[model samples]
Every structure is written in C-alpha cells, then in structure tokens.
Target: MKKVFSQIISLVMAVLVLASTVSWTVDKHLCMGRVMDISFFAHAEDCGMESAIATLDSEDYQNPCCEDESFTIEGQDHLKLTWSDLDLDHQVFLVAFAQSYIDLFVPLEKLPVPNEKYPPPILIRDIHVLDQVFLI
Candidate 1:
C-alpha cells in the first residue's frame, strides 16, 4: 500500500510537471514599433491539402505613442503590430495577424518560427515580459 501510494504521487507529480511545462509555452504575442496600433489573433483551417492562416492589421488600433515620418525595415528597427487596418474586414486582417502570432508566441523549437533571414527587431516568441518604467 505504501509503495502504491508513492507511485501514484509520483505519477501525479510528473503529469503536473508536464502540464506546467506546456503552460509556460503559452505567452503573449506582443509587438512594439512605429505603427499607430497593434493587435494579434489566430484561426486554424482545414483545406484538406494545405492549412489556411490569417492575422490582424496593426493600423486598426489606436496609434502608437508617437511615430517617425520615415520607417524602413532594413534600418534595423522594430515595429509594433496591431490587429486591424483602415476599413478592411477581419479575414484580410487575419492573414498578417496569424504570422505575427506565430512570430510572437511560438518557440524556436516549436512549429512556426520566425524567418530571421529577412530583418531586424525580429519576432520574439514564448516571451516573459513585465511593463515597468523607471524615472530618474
């Protein structure tokens, strides 16, 4: 009886550890940059042959704290992302939002990693973040 109870506790502890490990992978798909606003969302599709994906547009949300008139991807700058743009509907917006989500949340060891070959301020995934500021 003692051995059995010990084994059960061990199994339960293993299961909890696995559960917590997985939970750690779930984090925010955050972005920061010149965009007026940024947001993220996701959806999965069954096309039979290929999966369909979508993302939100950054322009749809409120503007950023500020903006620079000139923005370029090559200058090695980071940009915030939002879930919408102008009057465009959700479908169109989702196309980009999906990619952003993957780039923001998924891990390098997991599916859907970022394409770092392209540029700077690259996507950050499975991140732990806190919003704190210090004033001097």
Candidate 2:
C-alpha cells in the first residue's frame, strides 16, 4: 500500500511539473500576453523571410523581423535583412520553404497573427538539410 501511494504521488508531482513548465514556456519564450495585440502570423507576413529564419533560430517571440515603424524610437535594435544574410540560392529557398520553416518552429494555432480561416498548403516537402543548418 505504501509503494502504491508513493507511485501515485510521484506521478501527480511529475504531471504538475510538466504542466507548469509548459505554461512557463508559452508565457515567456512565446511572449504570450505581452504581444497579444500583434498576431504572430501577421507579424511573420510583415517581417517575411528574415523573420522566419530568426524565429527558427531563437524559438522565442522576439520580433524576428523589425522595421522602422515597428519600434517607437528610431535606430532601435532590429533585424536588418539584406541579401548578404543569405546566399542567392538560399534566398530563393527561403521563399520556397518559408511556411515549412514556420511550422517547424511554431504551431499553426499558436501563431500570434490572424489570417484566413483555413491553413495554407505546406510547400517544402522535407527540411532535413535546413534542420542541420538552422535548428542546431
């Protein structure tokens, strides 16, 4: 009876820990309440490819793409995407594989941005190579 009771207690404690960690991850890394006004999806659209790459790299909600208007002050730290950021072929690849890249980083429903009721078709068939490069 004591063994059974200890096992049950351990299970409950494990579940509670898992739940709290998930909640904390969603709140902190994903910037849940702080950026509620901005939809992650729309923000992605506005930020585009570089933002996609940044999101994949950080796995957090740090405005992967920022423009002049995106900040209240001028010269605010922001991701300035240039062709130099990625090679020519990679630039084309970014367009080709953007949605897949995003899916790897964030769930569709969790995307902070608003969009069409239906989800878009997945474009990139496989991202094994990209996984090696970006998701290290």
Candidate 3:
C-alpha cells in the first residue's frame, strides 16, 4: 500500500511539472456581444458577418459586427537546471541530505545470537508427570 501511494504521488508530481512547462492558447469568436465559438490551440471560426462585410464596397467598409479574440498563456521556458547553478551551501546540503536518505534504508548489521551454538539438554524423565501441575 505504501509503494502504491508513493507511485501515485510521483505520477501526480510529474503531471504537475508537465503542466507547468506546457503552453496553450485559447481562441474565442464573439458576434454581437455574445460568444459564437470557443476553441483551444486553434483559431476560432468566424461568424457569417465577416464575409458579408468583406463583400461590401471598400469605400463603405466599417468594423464588422463579429470579433475574434485570443489569449496565449506562456509557461516556463527555462527548465534546465545544472549542479553548477546551485550555491556551495546548497550543494553541500543536497549531498548531505542524499547521503542521509540513503543511509536511512541501509540494513542494520545482523546481531549475534547468544546461544546459537548451544544444544538443548537431554530429557531424562517426564517432568510433566513428576509435577502435579496439569492443564484443565
């Protein structure tokens, strides 16, 4: 269960990093103050008003009733970090932390058993029979 939980947490963190470093755009088309279409990562389709206005005489050209708007969200562009980028103190701390973390999982030395080489004493008589103690 702990292993599964750690895996899930790692996956979530990876996704979070990916999302922070990714960029996207949102395109919207509005006609007469009402949203006509909304799209992602692509241009929004224009309403029929644009073509109708284009066909009119150039001299009488005026702003079309429809409008197109776009919003671009830029994500982190510099994600490459190197060891040299860290300060000496930070590097030392990181090294110490890593060493300690590794040592945390190191198996402890096996303890010596006190009587591993000793054999059990030989039974000469039935001690349970000699004693009056009996289980009910």
Best by lDDT: 3
Name the weakest run of 10 consecutive residues (lDDT summed) in model 3: 57-66
For residue 6, give model 2's deviation from the true position in Å: 0.1
Indicate the residue-level lDDT of 133 in model 1: 45
* Position 113, candidate 2: lDDT: 62
Question: Could you tell me every candidate's TM-score relative to the true structure?
Answer: 0.19, 0.18, 0.64
Q: Deviation in angstroms for 78 in model 1?
A: 26
How far out, in Å, is residue 130 in model 3?
20
lDDT of 2: 0.53
Q: Which stretches in model 2 have alpha-carbon errors above 4 Å? A: 24-136
Q: Taking the tens digit of each residue's C-alpha lDDT, what string does model 2 give over 29-133?
A: 223223323332123123244456665856665653343223221222444668788988998888879978877876466545666577997967557765665
**Candidate 3 lDDT, tens digit per residue, 1-136?**
9999999999999999998988989999999999999999999998888787778888677765778899989999999999999999999999999999999998979977899999989999978889977888
Q: After superposition, how far is residue 24 of candidate 2 from its true place, in Å?
A: 7.7
In model 3, state the lDDT of residue 98.
Answer: 100
Ranking by lDDT: 3, 2, 1
lDDT of model number 1: 0.46
RMSD after Cα superposition, model 2:
33.9
